[model samples]
Target: MRAAVYRGVNDVRVETVPVPAIGPDEVLIRVAACGICGTDLKKIHTGSHSAPRIFGHETAGTIAAVGERVQGFSVGDRVMVFHHIPCGHCYYCRKKTFAQCEVYKKVGCTAGFEPSGGGFAEYVRVMDWIVRRGLVKIPDGVPFEQAAFVEPVNTCFKAVRNLALEPDETVLVIGQGPIGILLASLAAQTGAKVLTSDLFPERHRIAAEFGLRHPIDAGKEDVVAVAHAASEGRGADAVILAVGGNALIKTAMNAARPGGRVLLFAQTQHGDAVIDPADICMEEKSLIGSYSASEEIQDEGAALVFDGYRNGFDLTRLVSHRFSLEDAVAAIELASNPGPDSMKIFIEPNLAQV
Candidate 1:
């Protein structure tokens, strides 16, 4: 099998590797569609993790083989796998912070080396724990590329749900990338007026398909001013910083009302960010961070992805490029440096079937 192995910082090469063998309690999935995610790019450029690992996690495909002990699933079933599942009895699980659970931190899918997500390869072995709980069957008639969005949609949906949005509220989503569009679309579903911000006009045009009306051209217009204008002199009730890095943290904070909330969805990197303490203390604004998917909403997220396809929420339209396994390095490069027209990029191992 050909897998894109991460050798070191800023290095990824597609090389022939062994087809991972599954245990008696595990299963093997022939990869169909795997979306390139920002966290995967971050790890590749920063070398945050060790070398010789396969990193694509937004995956979906047909089961090539099932373990002897795996009952409810069969070899021919179509499914999407979550690389992490939390132990229901852990302290973090009890508090609903599943991402921090020790069991959840361990990657359960692999193509060959270290159990990092193996979706970048042709096939990935799903561990026993993931097979039991994290595996979700894709509904019939839906495309694998759409099913590949289940994991990312879960993460975005969790953030939107955490905001506790009201119908009368106004939200300013800072970024119009695929993830940013997902966040803004979900926020609009709650009846809140959504204002999308991005420097590219192409992204704003794509955002309009999801019914997002208000768009702030971050390149030419003032985001804070546009947010305030929409709210009648007050800033947005909630501002979601979907763009990566800490450069916009202060801007997001300033674009919210005195008692508004700011959700840091894409600031996954840990580092120093300059924020005014008086904003939280004197202005009563709140800074919240939502990361990863939640097990409690796993079923809901899957249902949304499945049912949404038939109900005007075709996520596949967001995919602008699809690369084969041999061209994964190029795929990663394009995803790392997105242009105005680039939306969601995918690597389809089985392009013909998917």
Candidate 2:
């Protein structure tokens, strides 16, 4: 088998490697489709994690082997797998903060090296706990590419629900990338008037399809002004910062009205962001952050993806490009430096087939 092994900073190569061995309680899945995530690119470029690991978590595939201890799953089962599953008994789990759970934070799936995400490889060993709780079987007609979105949608839906949006309010979402579009769409579904801002006109065109008529070209227009204008000069009731970079924190804050909410949906990386305390203290605005997916919303997220698939939302349409596992490096480059047309980049290990 061949896996894209991360050797060092900004280095990944497709090298022949042995298929991962699984424990009695584990399951082996042959990779079908894996999406390149921003977090994966960040880890690869920053060397945040040790090298010699395969990193890819947005994965969907057919089961190649099932452990003796595994139940309700067979060798030919098709599933969308999650790399992390909370212990469900820990302090954090009890509090419903699953991402912070000690057991949940540990990476449970791997290709050949340490237990990092192994979806970039030909096959991955899914630990027993995840096999029991984190894996969702793909329905008969849904494609693997669409099934792969279940995890990401969980994260996005988590953020939207946390915002506690109102149907009649106005919301501004910064950045019109895949995640941004998902955020805006979800917000609009709540009956809220959603405004999306992006420098790329192509992305705004994509946003328009979601019924987002007020697209703010941030590069050429005053996003804050437009957001205010849409809200009768009071600014948007809420603003979700879907793109990373500490610099956007201020812009998101400024786009929201006094006493409004600013949800930081991106800012996953640890760093310092400059902000004025006056914005929160004097203006009474709330700045909040949401990270990862919530187990409580897993079923809802999966249903949303499957239903969206059944509808014309066609989440897979966000996938703009596909690359074979052998050209994983090129896939990373394109995703890292997205053009106006690029949205979601996929790595189809079996691209030659379906």
Among these predictions, the greatest TM-score belongs to 1
Clashing pairs in 2: none
Regions of candidate 2 where Cα sits further than 4 Å from its true position: none
**Model 2: how far residue 48 lies from native, Å:** 0.7
TM-score of 2: 0.98
Worst 10 residues of 1 by lDDT: 345-354
Each model's lDDT comes to 0.94, 0.91
lDDT tens string, model 1, 1-354? 989999999999999999999999999999999999999999999999999899999999999998889989998899999999999898899999999999999999999899989999999999999999999999999999999999999999999999999999999999999999999999999999999999999999999998999999999999999999999989999999999999999999999999999999999888999999999999999999999988899999999889999998899989999999888999999999999989999998866422
lDDT of 2 by residue, 272-350 (tens): 8898899999999999988888878988899888778888767887899999998898899999999999999999898
Give TM per candidate.
0.99, 0.98
Q: Once model 1 is optimally superposed onto the true structure by TM-score, how far is the C-alpha of residue 63 displaced, in angstroms?
A: 0.4
